[model samples]
Target: MAGTGRAGVWAVGSAAVAVGLIVALAVRERTAAPTDARPLVVYAAASLRPAFTRIATEYEAETGQRVELRFGASEEMLTRVRLPSAVDPGDLFAPADESYVTSADKLGLVAESRPVARMRAVLLLAPGRMPPTAWGDLASRDMRVSLANEAAAIGRLTRQRLIATGLWRELEPRVRGAATVTDSANAAKLGAVDAAIVWDAVARQYPDQRTAELPELTGIEAEVRVAVLRQSARPADAERFLRFVLDPEHGLRHFRDLGFRVVE
Candidate 1:
């Protein structure tokens, strides 16, 4: 009887030890760092590269998630997102203007959009050139003016402003078009053109160049917008990233630091 009781106690002790070990292992596994962190893909306008890159870095550090960024002109990015392809589409699309987001939403490409920042078209002047005070000055025959190609958001805004002010027909002949806003700004910086119509942020990039506010461009600010794509495999992650970007302390601060105007 005594031997049997001792054997039963040993058995019980062994079983308890085994159960404790199993529970400990389970807890450790639960607390262990995740091995498979899915990456979030983002398609953004080229003009947003600097600020977005910084925000991506900060997000990755804080969330332990990865970010893949694709940068191009806003219209070009939109076209890429709309392309029918076998490969997976990006998780998010951030365009330089709100119209692109609205078009994407209409096409069922975007699930939702939020305005993140704002910018305005301005005249960037070559070194030693006097700033133009009015829209009519851009139509001067002697002035060699650089303008963004129609594909860029800045280009569309510039054309709209010119048309609204009745200067498009008169200034169209003097305009030299470039592929991107950066190129247009560079044309002025390199003295290839007397002036360029570019975003205020782009003009800020070349401190040596001068920026002039065209009275006609008033109230024509570009509203930068970010959207979660309908085809995104990870919509939650995309929304999280969008929230991070719109966060006043995190992403908007980066935008402001990079000379971008954050939308209030």
Candidate 2:
């Protein structure tokens, strides 16, 4: 009877130890870093693709975090941010101009925003084409000019410049509209149009493209801005990525290399 009682006692002790071990393993598994973490999603302006791509590559190398990029016109990107659902929520938004960021902020879509770089509009001419001396030159009947559509940030800026210089009405009839600033640049590159009003950085992107300064548009700069979205499921990671992009040696360097001026 004594031997049977001792065996029963030992059995109970072994079972408790096994249960404790199983509980500890379960807890550790729950707390451990996921082996396949979801990539951070970034929604950026089309014009920023080159710089952002390089920056994202560097960021992934440094942090071992994957980055998924979605590029489009700034206005379109803003619209996406305003309508994020569970299936399509984004982590960050980097628009071509500050006005869009401000608009997003006003709508409670942006948690925080920081200025990243600056760009100015310029006239991009096709190979062997003479640079236009002024905006009026683009209004010539012989000139085929492309401008971004009204829904794009660059489009709004270009229209505002034309209106402020009293050239919108005259130029409107002659101008063809592209969906984005990059598209405007491509129009000139592909000879679909003789020239385009595009951001300076985009003009530099194509070696065959020549730039003509628009003096009337002087001092009119687009302030590139990045913002953390209120809809981000991982705000900490998003903020960290934002800081990485703003770092002088990391993302800002790429922007500078791409012909963007640092916003002071």
Candidate 3:
């Protein structure tokens, strides 16, 4: 019994020392001879999460680079860029709406900002639920609908457009009385609510939940954008990433798969 106990202690100590050495070596490698290429940093809108992730992976595999993606509301991304070091200025900034893209661009945070993908507004239905074919259907007295707050997004823009055509004024009572506001359109994509007004990219991104197309005549359309952050350490790499995204063969197909419209 004593011999067995001594062997176990010795083996454990040996294993611990081996692990510590391996860790130290890895740290040394990271510090001493890190790659000259800057790590690809990206701050993006939540709606772009699905598509951007795919692009990021592809870019890394092709170039042997590392990518770090930050997902947040459009407003939060803007605020973080201006305020301080909470978020490292990544190689790229991708926003969910044109308004946000323009806002951040004007702040002088990026070398250039452009619409990478266009997303229409969409109506989301709960799991195993049927989507409304028209905006008026959302006004059904029994239907409990929701919309994300317009402060961080253009949902308010959508609402106003609807009202201008009188589509929303009739629905205003319905929206006010029942439509709950969330911080993001992605939240409305969840199945908990009966119906939600969300970005088209979100609707198409999560097909398992269920979505039916609203008529194209519906008064809402929005564009999603990308910008190269000025503070990024890898401007050339960032430009390469952007060029890869504009590549017709891969980038177009990738965006199309995520339900985005590639504008010429």
Candidate 4:
């Protein structure tokens, strides 16, 4: 009877040991699963929507990795990355201007950065309106112009250019502030304004709007840059996506198709 009891006890202990081993293996596998298996979160400037959307789709198909994209004004995206109140911090950021990346780097929020593209500011005129011959034409009382507010990269660039040319004061009264270059372009498209200053690429999106290339505005260009966030939970995966974007055949092609000047 004693020997039978010992055997029973040993069998019960072995079963428990087997169950424990199985649970330990499961936990180890769950912890060791490749972080790349999870979706990479990217906060991108609204201006990058077209190109990024396409690139992300292709990347998912090719690598079997998923991507979650959040688009807004470049500054707004930066703010979201910095605060991240109710949301998870993004793994990557692609702002329309490099300045935002510089600011993020100053805050110790950036792990790496790369230049993606470049865009020049241009005047988008409403249909049937003759392109202005000079900057002063925008200041004319008959002209109603819309410009992006200072919160947007294009808006900041527009203000800087207009100030340098000594036309900001003259043009200020005639200008209606918009939240983004896209908004300013929309105002022109809807004929809410006679003209708007927007990125050349944005102007291309509207076939009805005519782009005016002025020698004075030639110097206004923004370098679109992407950065890996230091606080990213999946840094390695984020880096892989970054490299895919920087690849000429993959991401740059889409930007070029959208009329964005692809940077080498």
TM-score for all predictions?
A: 0.80, 0.79, 0.74, 0.81
- List where candidate 2 sits over 4 angstroms from the true fold: 1-35, 134-136, 139-141
Error of 4 at 97 (Å): 2.5
Report the alpha-carbon TM-score of model 4 versus the true structure.
Answer: 0.81
Better of 2 and 4 by lDDT: 4
Off by over 4 Å in 4: 1-37, 85-87, 139-141
After the best TM-score superposition of candidate 3, give how far the Cα of residue 170 lies from its true spot, in angstroms: 2.6
lDDT of 3 by residue, 1-264 (tens): 366698888888999999999999999988955667547778887767777889888988888887778898677888877763634556788877778767867888778766677666666666766767665666663566566655645467767777677666565554422222233334444545576667666666566666656763265777777788787777888888878777767666689876778865
Q: How does each model score on lDDT?
A: 0.84, 0.85, 0.69, 0.86
lDDT leader: 4
lDDT of 1 by residue, 1-264 (tens): 366798888888999999999999988976653437647889988878998899999999999898988898777888988983546578999987787898889899988888877788888999999997676666553788898877677788778877987878888888999988889888898899999888787788888878898777676677888899988888988999999999999999998898888875
lDDT (10s digit) by residue, model 2, range 53-169: 999999999999989899987888889999998965899999877888999999999999999987888888977789877666776637888988877667887788779888788
Instruction: Specify the poorest-scoring 10-residue window by lDDT in model 2.
Output: 30-39
Pairs that collide, model 1: none
Return the lDDT, model 4, position 130: 90
Tens digits of per-residue lDDT, candidate 4, 10-44, equal 88899999999999999997775545555788999
Local lDDT at 171 for model 4: 80
RMSD values, in order shown: 14.6, 12.4, 6.2, 11.4
The residue pairs found clashing in candidate 3 are: 41-91
